[model samples]
Target: MTSFQQLLTDLGNKSLSVLDRNIPKSAYVPLDLSVTNAALKEVDVSSASKLGEYINRHIAMNEGKVAYGGYLEKRGIYNRSDYFNQQNPETERNIHLGLDLWIAAETPIYAPLEGEVHSFQNNTNFGDYGPTIILKHIINTVEFYTLYGHLSLASIENLQIGDVFRKGEQIATLGDASINGDYAPHLHFQIIKDIQQYSGDYPGVASQKDVVFYQENCPDPNLLLRL
Candidate 1:
């Protein structure tokens, strides 16, 4: 693990809540939406409704309220969008750079740590993050950022840059397919050691050739969430 990752792990001994605190950690179940999940071949994952149905079933079967996974995972879900792949296999941004927490739309998302808003925007590209928020956090004299994507439009409507949010504070609500890049309702949570010149947006997916750099810049969010 990277030193930053170890720092996140050492931040706490228990899981952090990104969703409503009422939901226990046990309510979260791991999900695999990677290219190797053969079960996807039988389903039309391109359709938001269809893919959502599959995910909902998985959650129900697992007796979980929320489904979360997909850090550095090679996903096929990006195949439908040219924004992610432009007919170039090697350049396709099919590797997810964040951890996705799948849940119902309008579900409240909380701040896992105290932070101030760095930026927020509504990315309109197909398969993009849609309404997104980036929070800057400094702990132990180290500076970093946390990104919350696929958020409801209202989440950014009245948000201001540098707005302070305490740990466990409600930062935003999950957006539905119509506004959240046409995907199932989920929060694309990511951590960045270095955001470069990005603002209100960052690549939540990376090409295989760029995976190494992205993997380092955007460490596993699980290092903090622990779920």
Candidate 2:
């Protein structure tokens, strides 16, 4: 493993959930796309409303407040032609790079560690992160970045670069389907060892060919979430 990867593993042991502790472990459910299911296979996941209803059903069935997306999940939700070619599933960017915490709109999101706002942007593409924030952090002198995507547009208002935030501080709130790149309400949290010259926005999903590289750059968010 890379030294950075080892550092992330170490941080995981000491990190806290990005959500409030009062939410309870029972409020979280692991969502796996690898399972063989007709709902995922046949449903129009690209539509925010459709996906929101699907996620709501999952929450209802499990009695959880949020649904968690596993690392490296082959999510078919990015099949929109604007984001990827619907004609070619093989070339689609369907593999999830970040860990998604699906929840209701306007739900508050917290910082898992002490950091400063590195950058923020409104990536207003049809299937893009509506308003995203990237925070820069240095732990044990190991510099890394944390990305928060699909957030409320208002979260970026009055924000400036280098804005400091404490651990567990309220950083942003979840955005609904209409605003959050037309997807269900969720927080796409990712860790980047190197941002590769990107600012405010980075790829949260990877095509098959680039998945291995992203796997190295963006480690499993569960390391920090611990849920």
Candidate 3:
């Protein structure tokens, strides 16, 4: 029911801290997610060479063949297809929808601003977001959604929808590999305008075919975090 302009105003007026800004230096470092130092890597996969490499890596990992590619997959294999059908355990297609901030386990996650808890769910599964939480915030008269995924199990145990929490409050802890979908623990933060009838967990990554759908439904969390 809130207007978008008013939402922006509320966010501006609210005292919010950027996710990486003011946090301890340790929080920014990679915790448990496999990481690579590829500064020259292109952010987008437009070349055949780049796209081919991405697919090969994905196929290798899904087949249980250990390779350096798994490290990238652990962090997140960029711009890869979200479909799977030939695995030992049947899998469904669901691309990630947000930028995953990979880091070590047990990092403290704080609320970006004061808001009410909108929803929470334990989405435990391989290749699935685990222990996700969505917060409904009103900024400048606009209503938006902030989703935190790969969270520690304790984070959602006591929370309820509509429970008010203060800015910078300790809302959740980062989940580690054992429970965070077998990847390094990190916060998967996303900004959503409409949940589209989905609750508990939303896509954190999407395929090129889904770019437009994701772009409108899920805005960049950086709009609020600026990180």
Candidate 4:
């Protein structure tokens, strides 16, 4: 195994699930290209609305509340011109850098660990993370940051930098397609080791050329989610 993977294994049992403990493990559905039990193959996931409908149906059929996306999965759902390349499909940013929790609008999001709000902003691009928040945490003297994207505008209304949040504290709420960069309701949770110069926002998707760098910079969020 790579050093990063070993690190995550070493830190096992020290992390927390971003979701509520009351939610059973059976309620979390693994959504990747390998999922063949759903009608995903027939749906036009390129369209955000259609993707939303597909996710809703999957959740209902599985009797689950959330649909989880794995790290590094090449999600074809981001084929929108506003988000990906319109002319050259080869340059499309399809590799997801974080874990996606697909759920209904207005669902509460909690901090998986103790941290302070680092920065926040409303990225109004066509297919961007409308309202985003980043938190800085120091665990065992190792500093890191966690990002929460595609949130309701009201979630950042009164938020300020340096605001401290306890583990499991409600931080934000999921947003709808209208204000969440015109996509389905969900939470984009990411872990970053070196944010570089970014403040409120960071790239949640990377190209093939830079996938290796991101894979190391942004380790598997399941390390913390454990779900």
Best by lDDT: 1
> Residue-wise lDDT of candidate 2 within 1-227, one digit each (tens)?
77887777777788487877689877898776543556686667767788778888888899998899758887655656457544665567878889989888899999989999999999888888899999999999888999999999889998999999999899999898778888888998999989889999999888888898999989988877778
lDDT of each: 0.93, 0.84, 0.58, 0.82
- Evaluated at residue 182, the lDDT of candidate 3 is 51
Query: What would the per-residue lDDT of candidate 4 be over residues 1-227, giving only the tens digit for each residue?
Result: 65555555565476566667678878998766333435677877657788888878878888998899758887666665456544454566778899999988898899888899999999887878999999998866777899999999999999999999998899999889899988888899998988899989999988777888888899988887777
Candidate 1 per-residue lDDT, tens place, 103-163, comes to: 9999999999999999999999999999999999999999999999999999999999989
TM-score of 2: 0.93
Flag the better candidate by TM-score, 2 or 4.
2
Provide the lowest-lDDT 10-residue window in model 4: 31-40
Which regions in candidate 2 have their CA more than 4 angstroms from the true location? Answer: 34-36, 86-91
TM-scores of the models, in the order given: 0.98, 0.93, 0.65, 0.90
Q: Runs in model 1 with CA error above 4 Å?
A: none
- Local error of candidate 4 at residue 221 (angstroms): 0.3
Model 3 CA deviation exceeding 4 Å by range: 1-15, 18-21, 24-96
Q: Sorted on lDDT, highest at the top, how do the candidates line up?
A: 1, 2, 4, 3
Model 2 accuracy (lDDT, Cα): 0.84
* Residue 29 lDDT, candidate 3, scale 0-100: 26
Clashes of 4: 0
Query: What are the C-alpha RMSDs, in order, of all predicted structures?
Result: 0.9, 1.8, 9.8, 2.4
